[model samples]
Target chain A: DQQVKQNSPSLSVQEGRISILNCDYTNSMFDYFLWYKKYPAEGPTFLISISSIKDKNEDGRFTVFLNKSAKHLSLHIVPSQPGDSAVYFCAASLSYNTDKLIFGTGTRLQVFP
Target chain B: DVKVTQSSRYLVKRTGEKVFLECVQDMDHENMFWYRQDPGLGLRLIYFSYDVKMKEKGDIPEGYSVSREKKERFSLILESASTNQTSMYLCASSSVTRVSYEQYFGPGTRLTVT
Candidate 1:
């Protein structure tokens, strides 16, 4: 069974608009969530992460909201730029020091002008 | 900055051949992981090591083995290459520091088995 899932395979958004990507996980034991962005032929880079203790965490233009009760989390990118186009993956771990991370299938985001 | 480097960016091998993929981390990380990325499968862990000479099986470990003779170098070995094993292999390493679980990934190696 897939513990973490990204139902949408892809998403398209207009530049300067808000882009929302959703992730759902079945494992309730997960306490740490993270998002990573990947470009073609490149390795995934860390984007943002939120601990289960908090409901939300925000960076400059990116925000990750976690609804632990709903077993869902969403990543919001405001003022999406063309440079933001890439594959996004959401991952979950049991704790902060867990070595294993369960990752979602990933959502490909395309921001157009 | 933490840097993970893979031995090859691309490799092609024939069936039944023994294949080896190497990974090295610049930072003194205690944990290292090897994952294979396939279409619609995200990243599946093949193997991982938390210390020198200690290895653990991940979600998938069949037909694969790992070696961690040193703290910074980890090797993934395929006993016999199979066509189904063709995929992109990614290497990652993370420190055992508190409050930090971010894993640094290498460029990845695209392996093809024919």
Candidate 2:
């Protein structure tokens, strides 16, 4: 079973608009969540993260909201730019060690001018 | 800055051949991981090590082995290459620091087993 899932394979948004990417998980033990961005040929880079203790975490143009009761989390990029186009992955970790992270299939976001 | 380097950016090997993929991290992280990314399947962990000479199998560790001889280096080995194993391999490292346990990844090596 997939512990983390990104149901949407792809998404498109116009520049300067808000882009929201969603992720869901079935494992209730997950206490930490992260978002990663990947470009072709490059490894994933950590975009943002949220602890289970908090409902939301914001960093500049990017924000990650976690709803533990719903087993859902979303990444929002405001004023989406052409440069923001890439594959986004959601990852979860149950503890600080041992099994480590479980990643989603990812969503390819395209920003149009 | 943290940097993780892979042995190759791209590699092609024939079936039944022994293959080796190397990864090195500059951050002195205690934990290192190897994952294979495939279409629709996402990144599945092949193996990971938390200390020298210690290794753990991830979700899919079949036909694969790993070596962590030193603190900064981790190697993934394929006993015999197969076409089904053709995919992008990524290496990552993270510390057990009190700040965070977020993993940092390498540039990735695209392996094509023919």
Candidate 3:
């Protein structure tokens, strides 16, 4: 069973606009959520993360909103740049000490000029 | 910066052949993992080791085995390669950092079983 799911397979946005990516999970045990951005051939790099206690976390142009009741989270990028084009993956873990993470299928984001 | 390196970028093998995929991490991390990525399947963990000479099977360990003879290196072994095993393999390592619990990944190895 897929504990975490990224319903959108792909998304498109114009430069200087906003981009939103959504993710859902079936396991309520997951308390930590992370978003990773991946280029074509390189490994995924960490972008931002949020804990279950907070409803929203912001880092520069990236913001992650978590809703425990809905078991859903979203990544929002303001003033999206062309360089932001890449595959975005959402991952979750039961806790920090657990170490192992369950990742979503990934959403390909394309920022156009 | 944490660096995770895989033995090969691309590999091809035939059915019934034995295949070995190696991974090495330079950050002196205590945790290492091996995962397979497919189009719609995302990343599925095959095995993981928390320390030298220790290993644990992940969600999908069928037809595969792993070894962690050293803390810096982990190996994934396919005893009898099958076409179904063709996919992108990734290696990752992580430390016990207080701020982040994220794992660093390698460039990935694309294996094709013919």
Instruction: Report the lDDT of model 3 for residue B38.
Output: 86
Q: What local distance difference test score does each model get?
A: 0.94, 0.95, 0.93
Single out the weakest 10-residue window by summed lDDT for candidate 2 chain A.
A92-101
Model 1 chain A poorest ten-residue lDDT run: A93-102
Q: Fraction of native contacts in model 1?
A: 0.57
Which residue runs does candidate 3 get wrong by more than 4 Å? none
Candidate 3 C-alpha lDDT tens digits along A5-35:
9999999999999999999999988989999
Model 3 Cα shift for residue B64 (angstroms): 1.0
Model 2, position B113, has a per-residue lDDT of 98
The fnat scores of all predictions, in order, read: 0.57, 0.68, 0.52
RMSD of 2: 1.0
TM-score of each: 0.98, 0.98, 0.96
Q: Write the per-residue lDDT of candidate 2 for residues A1-113, one digit (tens) a residue.
A: 99999999999999999999999999988999999999999999999999999999999999999999999999999989999999999999996453499999999999999
Off by over 4 Å in 2: A96-99
C-alpha lDDT (0 to 100) for residue A75 of candidate 2: 99
Output per-candidate TM-scores for chain A, rounded to 2 decimals.
0.97, 0.97, 0.97
Considering the true interface contacts (CA pairs under 8 Å between chains A and B), give the fraction that model 3 also has. Answer: 0.52
Candidate 1 C-alpha lDDT tens digits along B14-112 = 999999999999999999999999988998899999999999999999999999999999999999999999999999998888465688899999999
- The TM-score between candidate 2 and the true structure equals 0.98
